[model samples]
Target chain A: MDKKIKMRAEGVNFFYGRTQALKNVDILIHANQVTALIGPSGCGKSTFIRLFNRMNELVPDTSLSGNIYLDDLEINSAQIDPVEIRKRVGMVFQKPNPFPKSIFDNISYGLRVNGVRDANSIEERVEASLKKAAIWDEVKNRLNDSALKLSGGQQQRLCIARCLAVDTEVILFDEPCASLDPISTAKIEELILELKKDYTIVIVTHNMQQAARVSDYTGFFLLGELIEFGKTQDIFTAPQDKRTEAYITGRFG
Target chain B: MFTTLFFLGLIIFFVGVRGAKVISWEFLTQIPRCSMTQGGVAPAIVGTLYITLGAILFSLPLGVACAVYLCEYSPKGFMVNIIRISINNLAGVPSVVFGLFGLAVFVKFFGFGVSILSGSLTLGILALPLIISSTQEALLAVPQSIREASLSLGATKWETIKRIVLPAALPGILTGVILSIGRVAGETAPILFTAAAFYMRGYPKSVFSEVMALPYHIYALMTEGVHPDRQMAIAYGCSFILLFLVLSISGIAIIIRQKQRIQHG
Candidate 1:
């Protein structure tokens, strides 16, 4: 079977007020595949992923020279609205940020904001999204409770459900499990494995075990450049680059 | 703080005792008679209510909008810095200076005359700086994470502000409003030149008509009213009423801010 490309970046260079963060880099993301970017801190993995949704523009004095394609559409063009790009590409931050509202409202916020005004459809979608995030059974009894009252892992799952509620074609997770416990991290990893069958998933993780366990395609970034990227199995077992071998073998980050 | 509260307690006790004899249901509802020596200050109370409400109505939207622009939209530049400095300076300017400016602009130049319209406009200007600063603080108090989450969910900037930032900042905004109310209610200088009537019959029929207010009424009672003893007693009553109004507003604002802190904690 021929794998189709869902997103692509070409010669992307990013600068934050004259200091370059991402050097010239190129990568292709496949449809319905979990692509994990693994690197040390400040490797520009998160910055590169943010470019797909135009989130880097939120920072003042930041500039990008690149061509990022979301299924053949140049999302970086001035004519393309960032808001519309964000609708198609959703993101979950390192920290779970649930709104200070009820659980039901938190899940339905994205739907409501996207003009889903019908009550029955909103209710159905909220339930469906909660189930998709694998948090429905835990929270079904207390839909009206404040989301802040939930545990850390539950809140992260709720954030996932929120992203799913928007019907995004691509989901970006920036260190989603960085704050979770072992059990919660396992649960989130399982959810990510299941989710990639329907939506393209791109996650940035410091945990190599998480990348190896959940991702199909893995990209190893070293100091703002893509050093190696291929099938997760091939990169983990037979890394083509010495740096990828050294970093994956616990020699250095 | 203890020392100030002790002085405040003493003053309140003294005024409360002196004014107790004059204050009543009739004193509040009946119109002042015989140069305010016999009848109740109904018109003054009504006038103060109208003017304060008008000032809030005029300033709240303008103040909140200015705060939103300053906090959310304005780029950090020399122009924004200058605007912020001017706002702080405006807050420091004397109420008497604001009064003079209001008299020149709203009363004489704008042809509003010595009416509620002029007084409310003047009072609104006096309250603007305080309202803006407090509202900016309120908007700033909302966590940036909420804004990022909203925007990441594809909400427009205005939508994020309206749905997430504004809701989270509402209690703080209300606290600012309560404080502004206290300032507007107790202020005498601005209204004296722009809107205070020496005397008026019945309630003000329109914004163009002059109206009596509590602060200026107290001033008149002490300085120019007919009988010294009776006027002094009415002045105490008026002072007590004004003190009560300001204190209650402040009390409510403090309670709201405390509740908000505890909730966030």
Candidate 2:
């Protein structure tokens, strides 16, 4: 089976000032597929994912050389506004960071910022996004209550709903479940699986088991390089890189 | 510290007891007469309120904007570091020096004369560094992650600051403003050369009009008046009122800060 490429990174070398982080990295993210980047700490997995939305550029003295394409459009080009690129590619952080506002306002903030001025449309989109993120029933009655009042799991889901409200084509999860419990983690994993039918998803997880369970394509990253990339079954059963096999088999990180 | 509180309490107790004798409904409502030893300091009270309110009107927006620029927009470099240090140093400069500076700029150069406009502008400048530093600290207290979340949702830098950062920092900023009000209300130096009148016939009708103020009223009565005992009594009354105003402002700010801490926790 052949999958259409949604995002492609070619020879993407990233630097923080003079220190290089990603060197000669290349990967193809398939449309409507779950791609999991698994690696130990400081392996540049998070950095690699942030490149898609150009989030790294927000940091001063950071530079990237190479092409990151969202479909046929080169996202890293000077002509492309980073804000416009970010609108299409949404991101959820490692920790749940709901705005200090009402649940309804939190979800609608992205819509409002993107110039969705009609009140009815904003309300409908906020509800639909919450429902899609599997958090509507828990928060429907208290949509006006502060988002800070919600539990950790609910806040994470609310963050996801916030991302969904913007009508993004690709959603980036940066170790989203790192701060969650087993039940919340399971809920997130299930939601990611459900989401892959409609939206392209990229997740960076420290949990190898989570990658094996939820991802269609698995990329094992080690020390700023893509050690292996293939179908999850093959990567788990027959990894081409010895480092990937050793890391997966519990030999070393 | 206990000894310090003991003396402070002693001073407040004596002033409160003695000042209560003169503080009547008529005294608060009526204007001063007979070299300010007969009636009330009503004009002075009104002047203090106008000058303080004017100072806040001028300073709050200017200080908060400067703080937002420093915290949100200014790049971290040698220049920013120098700016931060300069602001801190501005806070430490003598209030009397600020008074002279205000006299030179607002009174002489701007031709505001010794009017409420000149006084308030001086007090506003005096309060500025305090407001900026405290506001910057408040903005910094907001987590960097919230900013990233807003940006990830494609909100512009100004949007995030206006919608999220500013609201989150408001309680702290308000606390700072209230504290600045307390300082501005009791300050004798800045208003001395710029705005305070030795004696005024009526309440100030405009910012350009000269006005009487509590601190300056008390100062004039105690030092320069003919009837020492009578003038000293009125001065004590003015001191009591000033103390009450400062303490209540501080009380409100403390309550607000406490509530914010509880809400955030």
> Per-residue error at A253 for model 2, in Å?
2.0
Which residue pairs does candidate 2 place in steric collision?
A: none
B77-105 in candidate 1: lDDT tens per residue? 99999999999999998999989999999
**Interface Cα root-mean-square deviation for all models:** 0.8, 0.7
Query: Model 2: per-residue lDDT, tens digit, B1-265?
Result: 9999999899889989988778888777789899777988999899999999999999999999999999888888999999899989989999999999999999999999999999999999989998999999999999998989998888888999999899989999999999999999999999999999989888888889999999999889988978989888888888899999999999999999998887776
CAPRI level of candidate 1: medium
lDDT of 1 by residue, A1-253 (tens): 6599999999999999999989998999999999999998889999888898888888999999989999999998889999998899999889889988899999788998899999999999999999999999999999999898888899999999999999799999999999999999999999998999889999999999999999999999988899999999999999999999999999998
Off by over 4 Å in 1: none
Task: Tell how far residue A187 is off in model 2, in angstroms.
Answer: 1.0
Quote each prediction's TM-score.
Answer: 0.97, 0.98
Alpha-carbon RMSD of each model: 1.5, 1.3
